[model samples]
Target: MSTFQRFRESWLRPILFFGNNLLSLIGGALTSASAFVLIGFYLVDAFGHGGSRNPYLGIILGFFLPALFLLGLLLIPLGILARHAALRRAGKIPSVYPRINLADPLFRHGIEVVLLATFVNFVLLGTATYRGVAYMDTKDFCGATCHVMAPEGTAYPVFAHSGVPCVGCHVGSGVGGYIHAKVNGTRQLIDVLRNRYPAPILTNDLLPSASQTCLNCHRADAWIGDKIRISTTFDDDEKNTRTRSLILLHVGGRDLTGKLSGIHGAHLGHIVYISTDTRHQIIHYVAKTEADGSVVEYTDTNLKQARVGVQRAMDCTDCHNRVAHSFDTPEKAVDRSMLAGAISPELPFIHKESIALLKASYGSPEQARTQIAASLKRFYQSNYPDLWQKDQPRIAEAASRLAVLWSQNVFPFMKVTWGTYPNNLGHNDYPGCSRCHDGSHNSASGQSISSDCSVCHNVLTIDDSNRSQLADLGVQ
Candidate 1:
């Protein structure tokens, strides 16, 4: 017999017989279709240029299609095995033993065909595995798949490190980090499926070590020098008088001599503290190690019990905890809008009105949007009738912008609103720098953590609208 004829009879006939069964047939069809679809998506994502990032592609290719493919692959073998058992019980074949002879043309042909099919199946499996893993690492898969992560999803894009992937910080480089993330992700997935996840999404368990994650991008020894920061605040008066505070931030880092100075240099890898609360808001004890290898421990004077709970080393995250996903306060949001020209600063009491609308409580996002716009429109029409008539479009535009700001920062479903996640970057907003350096923590030898403002930054000008300091430095 010809090689092709013998191969078809021995190999193709048996495969068709097993796979043609109802369950096996369905599984085979599904697996083939899903494999093709996933490959197509992978190709487009890999090669496409100048096209917008397609988040849904990651969902379909990384998660849904791979799951379907795996299910089908598993079903195929189970169906074939069941069919063999049923056939044996029915006495269609005397025994399940195969009549084999290596030298025979039929046997050789069957072996050849089996090897070929196996190779093809392995190739497809490899492709699917690669695509599945790659998809899971994407920002869309992490932030968009779970409704509980909506707050993070909304804030990430507007954050300073928006371009950086979620895994870059959450799951650092190396096999161990990847495995840890996957295991943790599985638990989170189970919680989501069972609806057992906590509201506001506590981040204590999700935090990765700063040395492994944050330090990967930010070098400790890199010179940061000083940063000039200008903050604008508006009064509630009719003129909405603008005032600017200019400060020279001493963000010094370690020099070649290994001398630690400034905010980051002073704290990074040197300070350890104990917090009684989960949020780390109430620090009870602090221990500082000097360059001479001497350790000085400080206890909070107010707290009767000093060593209350967990003692943790201070890291980058302690201060920059909300760096990637920070929500703005009502006042800050209004200030930003005016500065960006989204809301007219010329409008009388616009700052006060916008802040009031933002602070007001509402049941739903839709309600907030509608009410904010309505409230602003009513205020301008009733209080400043002439201004409202003259610049009706400006008022409406400002109201719409305010609504957008509210939606971006607040998520009613997740129980997140303005200031829900405290940004620990500054003292004025939250008990950030003051958590450890509030002057209340004193060592046994009488050394206290200095709460002096000059230690970290120098105030160039305080609430001066003239911006004299900026002008002198040739800055607008």
Candidate 2:
């Protein structure tokens, strides 16, 4: 009976139903996936803004999403059509089925089938095109596609809000800004692909919108009081000399409107600070702006620019740059390893040995670590046998800690070794606090970061050139 009944329906009929329904299901899924992807992206954009001035990722995403939705919208109709065809073959003719004939003697039936599938094909093609364009526009894809960004990109995870996308901060508000960023981003991609990219490139560019972009959040009306910066160092000797330097805080805030300028203006709600390279490339600018139209810019350049206009812009990141994800500073790197008891501070030349091992260098980090250990062992065994035995354990720990510190701070790939990525928040590398504090810059105002540390901050003691002299003041 089964065989007799099956004889009435050709194998081709079932194949037709299966093919039709499968295509229909896939088409519907494609449409739904597009919606889901868009929603998911919107959610990610909303919560992922950190260190971002434009806070409008949602806006841009919303704007671009419509185009993608159109593509999905197109896909839905094709899916509907496929489902109608399948139902008709199942003997459940859809109310609006196109009378397609598979039993035709000529090629008419095949032509109709081709036409039907073509509609679905076109929709899928559109979806693919939209996805391709969208992916290219994403900051993650833009900043992360190349191997060159690996070292720097790795830094982004710990910077600002961990979830913030790269575009949030780099690309700000408006269609004008959007267009500029697109053009710039494409050019950067080309640079990476062609290897025409410059080394030590600045992440932030000129025409920074400290005036517009930053002032939205930080206002200039909330600044007051003197700032104090104090630092201490530990010597292996019984006496851990503490050096103190205190500065009266100088910060400005915005007017009724949230507008602030420079670090001097906004301690809290005032403005942002940014920094640039010597040529004025805003390498890693940091700071916020206030509603009253004030801004604080602290550039990596630290005002070492030999020129202007061509000078770089600074961002809040320049100093408070490492706010959340702090890597090891050279001294701090030593201190961490020493404190952890990882290295042998007891080893002869423990400090000196750590320095040398760090300096010796290797092609790879693993190589560096291995060589550092060997170098220390050889140095101690060859020179100070007694100290090596006593301090070997501490020294070993120090070596490991140094290796980790080097791993975090030293980027040998970009020709950045220890002390290579110099911190210019203040002026050690390029005039730092001195740039503003120098009597020359303040000649008009009669204010300066004088040679006398006491002017800006009460210096309790001096560590460099003269370590023994204490200010006699409580800090000294």
Candidate 3:
């Protein structure tokens, strides 16, 4: 017989001894594959950095790669059992098909081929796993995924630590957080694929108890001292004059006993800033006596929530809600940019044109540029033909500024527009202070929160500049 036949009769013929044990060997190999994949994924997820930044990726790969390996492992035993049964009727022992032994010249190369292929597969899979983990860790994944959240990625650099991931605050610290965000993200993916996502894209559910997530680092008692409030303002496009306001809010905090106090002057060391889940708008608040031994919850009926039971505790996210995402209303952006001299102020009704141009509908950035250029040319030709004729260079500059504004603010390529994540810090954005103070809702302390502008910030002017000269622009 050939050398292969001799080897089969010797070492390979021992298959009869392991005829019933075939399943065990195959099962063990599959187990090894699964163990490798799971152990690999765990290292990648728990200790790796990539997946931490891109939450969506962690949602996809953190759970999927391990699952695939597990499924493959599970099938191995079933395959072995089926093969053994199939061969028993033929009086042949179950064994590794087309068995190759190193002593046999022709089949010896097959063993090396198997080893080499397995090695490459492992190396590549390991690299992919590491990359996936690192991608999940990136801030880009947190703020930019779902595409609608570009506003968040665009703004995170403006706030405090630029490198902090979204999960550091939103999901906080817990293994449960890791699982919850990923599972919810899967459902969100299905929705996005089916085009069934609700407007505003509500997906986060089973939010971890705020106690574990929010207060772990930001203990209420840790904050102390009065805070200086900085404010900015905008004016209507007509006259292009300033309509500024300022605030010196009494943001008092932790006192001698290390308890945060003076929250809206309630004398409660513990304050619960409550709001509607509608838009994360502050609706009403609850406060317990830091030492009074009474606990109560304050709700705002005026809050635009349809169903209740969505109350959350006050934390960094409660007030500093827009830390990662901020979109300036077009009027505000143009007004500030013009004031900053990035866009020439006298660029032929540029402020008005810029705001209008930004608000215009377009399919994409390229389309927006084309439409805005045509619209602006027509505007100057109709409204200020003489001025446009005189200051053509300034007009060009204004068009360029407006084009940049549209590109950054309106990314139609991703189906992203403006105002995706609205902040409820101020009364105008969502509900904010008005949720409680607007001549509606019940107060827990029987004390009133004011709707008057002066209550929080001094409004120097009103519908007209003459309002500033009026007699009754008084203090709160």
C-alpha lDDT of all candidate models, in order:
0.81, 0.52, 0.59
Per residue, candidate 2 scores C-alpha lDDT tens digits across 116-160 of: 655755564465456555655555554455556555555556566
* lDDT tens readout by residue for model 1, 251-278: 9888668776788788764788888878
Judged by lDDT against the true structure, how good is candidate 3? 0.59
| Order of the predicted models by TM-score, top scorer first | 1, 3, 2
Query: How much is 64 displaced in model 2, in angstroms?
Result: 20
Per-model TM-score, in order, reads 0.86, 0.56, 0.69
Winner of 1 and 3 under lDDT: 1
Prediction 3 TM-score vs. true: 0.69
335-409 in candidate 3: lDDT tens per residue? 767877776766545766688788888886678777887887788888988987887776676776777777666
Error of 3 at 348 (Å): 4.8
Misplaced by over 4 Å in model 1 are 1-30, 36-57, 79-118, 465-470, 474-476
Best by lDDT: 1
TM-score of decoy 2: 0.56
Worst 10 residues of 2 by lDDT: 50-59
